[model samples]
Target chain A: MKTILESIALTKIFKTGKIEVTAVRDVSLKVPEGEFIAIMGPSGCGKSTLLHLLGGLATPTSGRVLVDGEEISSGKDAVRTDIRRRKIGFVFQRFNLLPTLSAQGNLEIAQEIHRNGSRDRQHVDEILNLLGLEKKTHHKPSELSGGEQQRLAIARAVINRPAILLADEPTGNLDTRNSMVVLKMIQELNRALSQTILMITHNPEAAGIANRLIEMRDGRIVSQQQEGEWNAAEDRMSL
Target chain B: MSSQLILSNVVSRPMRSLATALAVGVEVALILLLVGLSTGMIRENSKRMSGVGADIVLQPPNSSLVLAASTGAMSVKIADLVSGIEGVKAVAPVYLQLNTSGGLGLVWGIDQESFNGITQGFVYREGRGFQGPDDVIVDDIYADARELRLGEEITLMNRSFRIAGIVEHGKGSRLFIPLGTMQRLVGTPGQATMMMIKCHDKSDIPGVKAELEGRLKSYPIFDMSSFAAHLEEANRDFGPIKFFTRTVVFIATLIGFFIIFLSMYTAITERTHEIGILKSLGAPQGYISLLFLKEALVLGGLGFVLGLGLTFGGRFFFQLLMPTLQHQLPPEWLLYTGILALFSASLGALYPALRAARQDPIEALAYE
Candidate 1:
């Protein structure tokens, strides 16, 4: 499979006053086309930072990243923004829907940002239906339940049909039932729609749905296993 | 869809939006009211002066186009010279005094017969014109405003005069007294403020005016058309009032600017996480900036409508209280003020919008 996203020795160091902390150090990874990969680690092990670097949300300190063969890490802000707009969709753990906008409005804003003339009513409806959010189209984020809000967030992220979906703890705030529903929807997106997905999670059951699992420790990937070799025991051990 | 987002945001915070809009509305109302009063007086005075039906007008040298400021410096004998011109049919020499007691007003002193000749006579509602030295003729507006009946006494120049007649308005000054009495009272026995000349033929005015100008080289002279143009230009360049209006406009814009800035700044702070979500959804800086700008514009639009309502309401109430006061709303200033207010609001939102756009997505997402 073709490599859709690649990070070469990615490193990120944050500075506060005179002190510096390395959040991510010398991490290299590649994601193939149409693959669902999960990165599991402890809270401070830089899993989220790695996802941000790959998604063009943050610049690497001493490395490079490319999405779909285009270098995003070294590009100008506008160039990187354009690449992100065209190729990447992000789902956050908090289900960051604009509280003022309805579910449909949230989806429309993403399409508006992407500016694809393909944001026809039919396509928006299709995405809402696919996320089981068709009934809550007019509901604002505060009006929707946890599962529904997360589903709406997912619908907003993929409304423009981006090349890759980067989900950061998408089910972290949901109950077990809602978490399962959200994870199943994500898994369905990857299996049925052939979506390229990279998810970060602390739940082994959530990671079990991915085609591949990568475990991280101290800002570096410590293990990579295929779907058949995925081990919940090893994930807990690494933590 | 973007518009929906903007509308939702504005509607979401109704009180803040209303408060900001009220500030902008007051800004707009301030410009409208102040400018209206000044321009209204100018236009009203100009209209009445022109309606006196003079073919040619002559003012004392160095006198302003503002009739209220006219000084009785020119000799009444200048009207004699003016009457001698070939096309001259009649000449009315009028003395004027500015009254600044209870309110600003102008008192006109006119020779009744000559004044009546130029204006074809006032339409009298009661009594007669300047029947005695102590008699005063007031227009119907002044009569109604002062609630004075015919033969009622009104004080002028510290002397009481009986209201001899109340005539229809639109001729000249609201209060008129005999020229001899006005001249004597002011201690300028031979002087007049201005000379209103009527020509025998309408086509002879230019020739008559030229002749008068040639003869009285030291006086300021004009035909009616030129006189109107001069007043219009003077109105445009009227310094003190212009400065006052501009200062008010500047202050109003500043008020609008600060209010919008604070409103948008607070909104940005509150919506930090939403901005992060938008940025993550690949919204460019321009898009984010435009969102806030559109919201400000919406507020400005609402404020404009509110301002207009306040202005008209203010005018109605003011006129109800002071029946004699004339208030004119210039049509063009409405559009200019609206555009200026919106532009100011956009400028106000600029800093906050740019700050929102420049926010680090990661940091913003982590913002609690």
Candidate 2:
């Protein structure tokens, strides 16, 4: 499979006054077309920062990121923003749907930001139906339940038919049932819609559904487990 | 997306939006009233003075060059001196005063014989001219408005006088009594407001005007054409008044500007999280800034509409109460006010839009 996204030797540093903190250090990763991958880590382990760097939402302090082999990691704001608009969709852990807009409004906004002709009403309706948000399309973010909001955010992320979907803790705010529903919807998008997805999660169960799982500790990937490899590792650890 | 975002923000805070619009409306109305009243005065004065039909008009030194009000201070004496000049045909002594009962009305007193001799262009509609010291000739429009007719009695300066005749329109005044009666009535027995001079021939006007100017340096001599030009020049006196009004307009605009600025700034500040979400969705800075700008522009448009309503309503009531003040609500004024409202609103939104554009996507999304 062609590599849809790749990050090489990416490092991010935070400088507050006289103090310097290294958030992400020398991380290299690749995601192939139509692949579903999850990165699991403890708090402050730089999972979110890595996701941002991959999605072109932030310029890495050093190294670079590629989308379809096009370097997009280090550039001006407009360049990165343009690449993000063309190729990336983001779903945050907090379900970052615009509270002022309805479910459909959020999806429409995504298509509009894409600046392409992908904002077909029929396609939007079909996606909403697939996400089971057809009945809740007119509801605001606040009006929807936690699980519904997460699903709407996911629908918005993919509405533009982006090259890749970058989700950081997509189900972190949902309950157990909601988390399962959201994870299943994400898996459906990855398999049925052939969407390339990179998700960050702290839950091993959430990582279980991914085709591949990469575990991180203290800002470094400890090991990568493929399909069934994660389940095997979990079983071995439990024993 | 830009339009939808703007509409949502505006609709979300209906009260704040209305207040900002109303502030703009008030500023526009202030400009309309101030500019309209001054324009009305200039236009009306030119109309009345142009209708006089005299070759030359002479007035007291300090009075308006064309309106010819005497203030009862100029001696009826100027009429005699001007009449004795070469080629002088008629010298009509007239006393003009502002009536206390009505608006800035002129109460004119004329000598019937000499005033009638010149083709003053007044047509009598009913009855005869003034026959007694107590008889007055009233204007046709004033008669119809006040429901007055020939032989009807009306009080002037506490004195009851009969309306001996009704005259046609364009005579510049409603109440017309005998010149001697007006001089005695206003307690200035030998004073006249101004003298309307007619030469024996149209060619003799220049000589007569020159002679009058040379003899009475305290008085100004203006032929009909020059009088119109003089009035046009006098229109410049409104410059300071207009400047003062414009200063007030600027202050009013500032109030509207600040209202929109503060409200939009605070609103954007409160919505920083939403901005972050938009940015994460691949929305650009221009898009976010345009959202706030369009919102401000809409508020300005609303304010302009409200201001126009207020201006027309206020003009109607003001005219109803004071019939003498002419308010010409020019169409261009409305257009100008509308444009200014939009411009000011946009100006107010600029800072906030820039601030919104500069918001960091990560920091904004991370905002709680």
Candidate 3:
């Protein structure tokens, strides 16, 4: 399988006046096409920062990141923007949906940006149905429930069928029931549609649904585990 | 869709948007009034000078034109020298003095026979035109303004004068009297402010003007075709009303600029998180900047239309309410004012738009 994403010793440093803080340090990683991977860590461990670097949302201070074999770490803003638009879809913990737009309008914004005003209604209906948002299509974010709004956001994120989905704590604001629903929907998108996903989360249950898991601590990757081996590792760690 | 977003944003806060637009509207209305009054004054002054139906107007070398008349004293004898010019058919030496009624008033002193023969477009609406030494013809504006009836004596310049006739407006001065009476009253007998000359043929104006200029080399001369230029040049010496119109327009633009700047900046601050989300969605910097510009443009367009309506309607009521004041707003000025309002609002929005566009996606998303 072709590697869809690769980050070689990627490091990100943020400068605040006289102090320099490293958010991601010497992190090397790779994911094949159609793989679903989860990064698990405590808060402030730079998992989100690592996801940001891989998704072209932020540039690394050192090393390189490649998406579909094209180098993006050193690309200029416009090129990085183009990559993000055409290849990556992001979902935030807060949903980040425009409140003024209906679920349909929000989906249309993504659709229009992807093809410059060309839209496939059937494709949109399919995504909405897949996310169980068909009935809530015309509802604004304010009118939708927490789970419905998150689903609408997921629908918006995938409406363009981008190559990769980068979700950062997508269920952080949801209740346990809604969190399970969103996680199940994400797993369905990966398993049924062969979609590639990279999610940052603190939930072990959420991590268990992914095909592979990477654990991070102090801005560095500590271990990588496959789903087949994850159960045994969890058992041994608990012991 | 982007423009639609801007529209939705505007509609979301109707009062703030309207207040901003109304502020701009006030500026537009003020600009319209200022331009209207000043241009009207300039045009009316030129009209009065040209309305004497004169082929040439001769004044002292340095005489300046006030709003409705010439200033800087000169010899009334210029009429004698100018009347001898080759094509000169008639001469009228006009004595102009500013008088006060309720507003700035122009009083013209003319010899009835000569001034009336050369002047056209004047017809009495009631009574007669200038008969007795103390008799005067007042335009409808002044008559209606002072509520003077025919044969009513009104004190002017501390001298009592009877209103013999009330001529229609636009004929000339608000007040007219006999030349000798005014000359004596002003204590400048045999002196005139300017001389009006009529040629036998209107086409012979160039020849008449050349002849006058040759004999009266020290005097400033004017003809019908070059009247605006001449008045403007003469006005240079009198010190134009630099503050009345230009200053008002400058202040109006400044007000419009600051209003839009502060309003848009506040709006951007309020929508910082939205801007960040848009950026994270892969919206280009240009796209983000364009959203703010579109907002301002829509606001400006709204303000411009409102201002135009108010200016026209307000001026109508004002002109109707105050018969003494003349308010004439030309179409070109109306169009210019509309453009200025729009342009000022857009210009004011530029800095805020740039600031919004430059906001980082991460910071904006986290903004409160």
Interface RMSD values, listed in order for every candidate: 0.8, 1.1, 1.3
Cα error, residue B131 of model 3, in Å, equals: 5.5
Q: What is each candidate's DockQ, to 2 decimals?
A: 0.80, 0.59, 0.49
Which has the better lDDT: candidate 1, or candidate 3?
Answer: 1
Model 1 residue runs over 4 Å out of place are A116-118, A233-239, B157-160
Off by over 4 Å in 2: A116-118, A231-239, B50-91, B94-194, B197-233
Best by TM-score: 1
lDDT tens string, model 1, B114-164? Answer: 999999999999988887899999999888877889999988888888999
Clashing pairs in 3: none
Candidates sorted by lDDT, best first: 1, 2, 3
- Candidate 1: which pairs clash? none
Query: When superposed on Cα atoms, how far off is each prediction in RMSD?
Result: 2.7, 5.3, 3.9
Ordered list by TM-score, greatest first:
1, 3, 2
Where does model 1 sit among the CAPRI classes? medium
The CAPRI class of candidate 2 is medium
Give the range of the ten consecutive residues with the poorest summed lDDT in model 1 chain A: A230-239
In DockQ, how does model 2 score against the reference complex? Answer: 0.59
lDDT of 2 by residue, B1-368 (tens): 65776788788888888888888889888888877887776666666666666788887787764353334258877778888998988888788866666334667888888777554546889987878999988877677767787898888767788999998766556677899998888788888777888888999998988888888888866898878667756763555665786787789788888888997898888899988887887777888888889999999998998898888888998777665567876688788888888888999999999899888889899888
Candidate 1, residues A1-239, lDDT tens digits: the string is: 99999999999999999999898989988899999999999989999999999999888888999899999897466777888999999999999888888888888878878984235777888988888888888888899999999998888777777788999999999998898889888888898888999999998888888889999998999999988786563443211
Q: Rate residue B165 of model 1 by lDDT.
A: 94
